[model samples]
Target: MVHAETVAGRRTGSPWLPFAVRRLLGLVAIFVALLVVSFLIVQLIPGDPAAGLAGADADLADIARVRHQLGLDQPLGQRFSDYVGGVLSGDLGTSFMYRQPVLTIIDNRLPFTATIALSAITIVLLVAIPLGMLIGVLTQGGRRRWLDTGFGFVTGLLDSVPGYVMATFLVVMFALGIGLLPLFPPAYTPRFGSASFVLPVAAIVIGPICTVSRVVRRETAVVLGNDYLRTARGWRLPAWKRYVKWALPNLLTSTLTVSGLVLTGLIGGAVVIESVFALPGLGSGIIKAILDRDYPVIQAMVIVIGMIAALINLLVDILLGLIDERTLGGSHVST
Candidate 1:
């Protein structure tokens, strides 16, 4: 998967040092941008935040006091500076609605979101990699051509379905379109090993499994056609060595790249899934915070989610570098 042009750009200094420094610098830059954007975006929302939160009971002076309390009376630059200073000192401020520290609320809700995301991703990797390789091997050279067409059709259809739509459909079909659930329990809890998890997890995994599997399947087909693989066959190598040693490594590279993207999408996509299932995950929590104009909660969740997304992409690059340093390019790499 390493591009040819990158080879000429490689540094002669040290092997991984230059690459690691460059990546860490880029990560820090991304984090700064994430903080600025997350903190500022809520200020752009329409209406007076102080007045809205103060509600009908408060008079004009009460609203002004509320604005002062929130630093809304200050200049935009001054407010932003204070916000950054507070965050750097590890204070996310208090939630307007919850009347508690923002970090405390997030810590309380983190496990629910973590459970769904982790469960869904683990299932996707387990199912997609094997299914993809099997289909690739079976349909090679146009043998069993019908499997290719069917596989493409099915994966495309499954992947196109949104998480909310899938969640709703699953509930209706499997839950008998009623309040009662037959095959699975009604809701999710952190009480591990709950049968209630089955439906929500199934909803989350459908699209990701289809996406990662298709990438693997296509990569496998390409690797199978490689000259080195053909040469291995000519030498009468064992099937395990020919396929496992030669074919699977390339599959891992592509699979890891696509898996990272799918994970980022999962963080965003969990909102609708959480809504449908009435789960108290970060996704659903953000929706509530937005509606209530809870700035601390909103900003903190955005920072947390952005950090997760950035970290995932960074880890993927590191893995790609491990496979071959050339994949990470050099100092003057293209965007």
Candidate 2:
């Protein structure tokens, strides 16, 4: 009893489910490809595995014996198979330099790193969205050019400053210069009630918040300039409600994408900031691994960081699609 017009409308309206399913599958395949590529890239780095394991003075016979024991004599295909199997089984192989299981190293350090990343992201989103919205709304009146100019300058300055510089300046001013806190504590006990993590979290948040706020401000300005928003304003609706209903939804979709990029930037930035503050996060672990050339630790850290970045971007895209059906449906029709 369904007419052709009804069927066509249904098809257009319900296209999102199939499109979303395809995007999800694409995300999974990309992550799998990253894992395989990471394994191969790490294996390709030139080095004497035995020398990396044992000291340079280790006897040739002992080195050969160690290589044989570690299955370095196997073909590349077999090694790759073993690597994939081990990864699937939650075994990241032994660290030639650290002489411990790679999973143990990652497992021990994951909580601290996750906490820092989560805290930094929370700070960025919580602070940036409102600030950007305010700036965007005010600048729309043509009376706040100075404010907009000042905000732009400050954002650019913060974005240009590296995380380490900001961290160091904070440490000098807050800890050494003011003597209000300890000079970059060495151990992080990770107690929720403790005051230990406050400064470090603040340091990570500063650059990201400023950067995210700038992106949001720019995007919100563009969104507010759209004809729909202008039409809403002409309707004499309540100013705040008009912005909330019309401006924020569009701004936030774009902001979520910027937030993902900030999260990606956080991976590298956190390493330095965490190290400078001596937080026992994955960042510190990466620094130590580099100093010691712990191959498994380094590779595992890279894989974790890369996966996190990719996953955040994927989630952001999904969020954008879900929040704005117009975009999703439009893209589906075009495809």
Candidate 3:
């Protein structure tokens, strides 16, 4: 009979299964750590949840009663155990300010946050990838030094600007200065196909485009300089054909890795951009929850965002494994 280890050593059914299981375990560990840290950090914030619940003018007795009612009077160890257990059981607790379930609040705001994140990623990939490839190809050919310098300078400038600052500038330029679009209406109520999405999406895309393009350009340059690509050139292949058929496929591994990071950054950046645009998203909700010392809402948002980042990275890993079999513990497959 064949042993399991021998079967694993040979190019058997699916090498990816073991790697995927390991990655899943790692993700679960990260999620647990995130919850513990989030809970502890929120607890460390300097404020009384009881007071927030009871109001400033409330009598001492009222505050005491509120504390007891919310289980704030419980021992720290007990409270933590309860919190972790509740999270594992799909009970995120109720929002202190909204007096509603934390899950319900998140469910309502999730679509808006998701829309912004997704739209920004779509814009980044569509715009940055081609632009970066073109720039890389041009620079590799030793043409357009001035154009490369200009692009480098602009991307550098954009990288330095924060999301809110960029959002403000876009609003000033397009909405206020040009009188081209209505900023308030869209900021207040952003719709998928509406014009209001323009400014917000632009703001979210700016930094990522600069960052991802630079990475893609560098990677593309490296791919273009490879010996095989030189061999392809020795055959007198057309430039476009070489790039499309040879350079791009080789460049995808690195570009895809960078895309995962860009996706995570976009999610984080959306919080600030969403606030600046006055968009009704998790970012604004998180801000309000913090100011109000609403621990449930804050904890829930942190968990959701952390999960998103983890999932994106995980998906990128799986895709990388598929593209390059060596990543799944097998021999490298030729491109």
- Find the candidate with the highest lDDT and give its number: 3
- How many clashes would you count in candidate 1? 0
User: Of the candidates numbered 1 and 3, which has the greater TM-score value?
Assistant: 3
Worst 10-residue stretch by lDDT in candidate 2?
326-335
> Which digits, one per residue and each the tens of the lDDT, describe model 1 over residues 29-124?
987897899888888766777898788899999999999987789998988898898888999889987789999999988888888777877788
In model 2, what lDDT does residue 123 have? 74
Tens-place lDDT per residue, model 2, 249-295, is 87887788778788778877878887888776788987787666565
Q: Residue-wise lDDT of candidate 3 within 174-226, one digit each (tens)? A: 99899887664643544675677788888889899998898888888899889
Q: Please, what is the TM-score per model?
A: 0.88, 0.85, 0.90
Best model per TM-score: 3
Per-candidate count of clashing residue pairs (backbone under 3 Å): 0, 0, 0
Clashing pairs in 3: none
Q: What is the TM-score ranking, best to worst?
A: 3, 1, 2
Candidate 1: stretches off by over 4 Å: 1-13, 176-188, 191-193, 330-335
Candidate 3 TM-score, true structure as reference? 0.90
Lowest summed-lDDT stretch of 10 residues in model 1?
Answer: 179-188
What is the Cα-based TM-score of model 1?
A: 0.88
Clashing pairs in 2: none
